[model samples]
Target: MTKKTRYGVKFYSVCTTDDYGLNLQIYSGKSDEAEGLSKIQTLVHSLMEPFLDSGHNVFMDNFYNSVDLSGKLLKRKMHTTGTLRQNHKKNPTAITQAKLKKGQHLSKRSKNVYISNWKDKLEVLAVYH
Candidate 1:
């Protein structure tokens, strides 16, 4: 008999704001990646609809990065900022020769930057820790 491997696993997470950092909302489920994302979107919409309706800013990680997701949040009038993954390929020009001229310095850097869909450009910033 041949052995089979299970590909899906239950993912759990607690979504909250940067200000408070911890809120009493936890979600867990056993599903594929797409289903997990859909569940998260539904949960976020339900929990954050009021805040979004009142014009609040919502910060998220790149895991939730998508044009559709961004559009949905923007439709609710919420601003967002997050560290986008390099593999996202949202900004092709962001990794040009000019930007990567100093390969060594750039390789070990994780800088605070702003990327916008409107302009599709990156603006690096100096943030105080």
Candidate 2:
């Protein structure tokens, strides 16, 4: 349930949200040469092949969400909802550092996706498509 990376020599494992055992898919961080988004895409494809095009929604955290990945998943008929890192490719720059009050939020949408930023104790960016 654990895999190691070559660059930072990091290790990762998939844990289930429920109280069940850990998820079987063990994904190491991408190799040192792999690009950020490409690495995420590769891992997702490998782990989600059977579920693609099945109209399922995949929820993920910042480590696994990105603009490129969200669009790709949507094309395969799968939807994604999750937090995204601000520096991800094609992710909007306007809200990355924008300061929002307690209940303020910013949102934008594309043909098949929507992105939003909410401010609480800190800024949170969410993407869904």
Candidate 3:
């Protein structure tokens, strides 16, 4: 009660303005990893399974964003734009490690993946890869 932090079960949900939840999945400890995908990637895939191959754009934050996942989603006709987790191993080190002054930005691309890193209070990496 003295602290500001509150902890409880975490759930992943896909919702729209019209409906509270179109789909939902509970995080129950460890889940089986799908082939060629990490646990987090699998989680997103499962929740979005019914929505794939229909040219949908997914906007996500760093917690659910990764270079590999972005590329995989592209193949399924789903485009993703999101902030990348700074410590994610799959992030391009050259782009992420580049030093930038406040308000400055650095960007790089490989094949179809484009990564842009911006400096504000901290470096935030955004990828449309």
Top-scoring candidate (TM-score): 3
Q: What is the C-alpha lDDT of each candidate?
A: 0.46, 0.76, 0.87
Candidate 2 local lDDT, residue 9:
45
Collision pairs in model 3: none
Q: Rank the candidates by lDDT, best first.
A: 3, 2, 1
* lDDT (tens digit, per residue) of candidate 3 on 50-103: 989999888888999888888899899989898998789888899888889999
Q: What TM-score, over all chains together, does every model reach?
A: 0.45, 0.73, 0.86
Q: In candidate 3, where is summed lDDT lowest over 10 consecutive residues?
A: 14-23
Clashes of each: 0, 0, 0
Q: Which pairs of residues clash in candidate 1, taking residues 3 or more apart in a chain or in different chains?
A: none
- Candidate 2 lDDT score at position 78: 87
- The RMSD (Cα, Å) of candidate 3 is 3.5
**10 residues in a row with least lDDT, candidate 2:** 7-16
- Show model 1 residue runs off by greater than 4 Å: 1-23, 30-37, 89-99, 103-129
Cα lDDT tens digits, model 2, 1-129, are 788755544434343466443334554544543354476677776666777899987788998888778888899998899998988867877766677898899988866788899988888899997
